[model samples]
Target: MTLSGGNARQALSRRIIDTCKAMNASGINQGKSGNVSARFGDAMLITPSGVAYDALKPMDIVLQELDGVCAPGQLLPSSEWRMHADIYRNRSEAQAIVHAHPTFCTALSCRRESIPAFHYMVAVAGGVDIRCSDYATFGTEDLSRTMITALDGRKACLLANHGMICFDGDLDRALALAIEVESLARQYHHARQGGTPVILDDEQMTDVLEKFKSYGRQPRD
Candidate 1:
C-alpha cells in the first residue's frame, strides 16, 4: 500500500477514504464536517460534499482540477475544495490536505489564541506557533486567501473560528500531525488552568529542529 509508484493515485484515494473513516470514528470530526484529498498528477481525489464517511466508496470520491473544476464525476467535490485546491497549487510541496474541526483545536482557534510553542513537538507544525488564519466564511474566496496566508512555508495551520488544516507530503504524516496538534491544544488548555505555561526559548527550539533533521523523519514534502 506504499504510495511510491504509478499506482500512487489509487493509494492516495484509499488513504483518503480510510483517514476520513478513522477521523470520524476517532471523533476528530463527526458527520460531514471534514474533507480529505490528495494530489494525483494535475488532478486530485477528494471526498465529495455531504457524504457520510462510513458509507464512502472509492468511486464516491470526486476527481477535480487543481483549479477546482469538477472532473467527469457524478458527485460534487467538497465545498471546501477551493481552499484545498489553492493550497496545493500554491504549496508545491503539499501532497495531501485534511480539514477537520477537532474539538480542542477548534475551541482554541475560536478564542483568537494561536497555539504557542509550549511543547517541543510544536515544531511538528513547521513553526514555533501554529498560526491561525482570520475568520472567513467557509467555502469562499476570502477563506481560501486566509488559509494560504497562514500556511505559507508551514505544514499545518489552525483555521480562525473554525478548525484545523494539516497537509504534508503524504497522508499518514498529515493525519498524525492533525492528531498531535489536537493533543497539544488539549494539553495547553489544561495547563493554562494551573498557571502560565513555560515555553521553550528560541535557541532551544532551534536545537530541537536540528535533532528532528538528524532523525530524518521531518515531513519534508
Candidate 2:
C-alpha cells in the first residue's frame, strides 16, 4: 500500500539520487560528507555512504525502515542513517531530510554558534534563530537525541562543531531549505567578522513567521 514497488518506488528512488547529486552541485555539500533521505511508507529512501554522487544510480539507494532495517541493496546506508530515522520517527511532519557541511554553516558550527535573527528569513526555519545542538559524536543515538531536541518546532538546526540539518514536506523543498540555510549561515559568518548582528525581536519574528504561512509557492485553487 506504500508505493512498495512497481514504477512509483523506482521514480522515488531516482528523485532521491538526483537530489543527492544536486546537493553536491549546489555547493552546500562537498564530497559525500552530507546525506539526503525521503520518507516513503513506513521507511525512508536514503543515499548510500561513501558513494560518489556522480557515480550513483537509482538502484544504489538504500531503503531503510523506521525500525532500523534496510532493504537489500548494493551498498550500505549513509553512516548518518540513524539520525534520519530518528527524525522521521520523532517528527511526523518531516517527509525529507537533508544534512550537509556547507562552508559557512560548518564554520559557525565549529564555533558552536547559532544563527540569530539578524535577517528576517531566519523565520523561515520556524524560529527566531537557528538553534545549534550541543556537540555530540556523530552517528550515535546521543547525537540523534540532541539533534531532535534542538530541532523541536524548527525545520533546521546546526550540529555543534559539525554541520546543519533540515527537513521539509518533500525532497525539493527540503533541498531548497538546505540551500537557503547555507546562505543564511554565510551572511551570518560575514556579519560576525564586524560585530554582533542586531537580531530581530520576537514580535517581529512572529509576524514574519505568520506571513510565511501563505508565502512562497502556492498550490492552485
Candidate 3:
C-alpha cells in the first residue's frame, strides 16, 4: 500500500532510522559514523548528525533540498549530507544511500585500494570493479566530487582513506549492498593474505551482470 502526504514522510523517516540501526547491528557500521538517507520529492531526508540511531525519532530526520538548503529548526543533517545530495542529483536511479565504515571496507580504503573483479560476485556492484575515490577531506565538496567520480557506472565505491558508500532503489537494498560490499572486501583481504587472487575476466563479469538482471526475481505468469 502507498502512503501519501505526512504519512509518507513519516514512514520514510522511520525506515531511515531502522536502516541506520540495522547497519550497526549487521556490523557494517559503528556508532554514529555512518549515515543514511532517502529521496523525498525535490528534497532528501537524512539522518541527523551525531545522534544515536536508537534515539532517532521520525521527527528527528532532517529534510534538505538538493541545492543544499535544509529546513529550519531541525537537527543538522549528517556531515556527509553533501555527498548524499550530490549522488541523488547526479544519479537518477539513487532512491536511497548508505555510507559506512565497515572494518574490511575501511581497511581497503585506507590503502586507497579499489575492489577488483577477483570474484564473479563483484558484478553485484554493477561493475567489474569498485573504484576508490581520490582522497578528500570528509564532508567537503571535494569529497562529494571525488565520490561521484568513483561511483561512475557503479552502485558502490570506497572513499579514499575513508570508507564505503552504496545506493539503490530503496533503503533496504541500499543497506544490503553496503553489507555485500563489505563482505567482498573481507573476502578479497583473505585472498590476498594467501596470495594474489585470480580475477574474473571482463567477459565473464559481463555475463554475470546479465544474469543478475533476473537474479532472485519471482517468475512471471
Off by over 4 Å in 2: 1-4, 217-219
Q: For residues 1-221, what per-residue lDDT tens digits would candidate 1 score against the true structure?
A: 35555366556677799999887777788788989999888888899999898888777888789877775635998989998899888988888888999999999899967888888888887776788899999999999999899987678888999999989888777788888888989998998999999998878888887777666556678
Using Cα atoms with residue i matched to residue i, what is each candidate's TM-score against the true structure? 0.91, 0.95, 0.98
lDDT for residue 219 in candidate 1, whole number 0-100:
66
Off by over 4 Å in 3: none
Clashes of each: 0, 0, 0
Clashing residue pairs for model 3:
none
What is the C-alpha local distance difference test score of candidate 2? Answer: 0.90
The CA lDDT at 180 in model 3 is: 96
Task: Indicate which candidate wins on lDDT.
Answer: 3
Query: Which residue pairs in candidate 1 collide?
Result: none
* Candidate 1 C-alpha error for residue 95, in Å: 0.9
TM-score of 3: 0.98
The 0-to-1 C-alpha lDDT of every candidate, in the order given, reads 0.85, 0.90, 0.95
Judged by TM-score, which candidate is best? 3
Stronger candidate by lDDT (1 vs 3):
3
Worst 10 residues of 1 by lDDT: 1-10
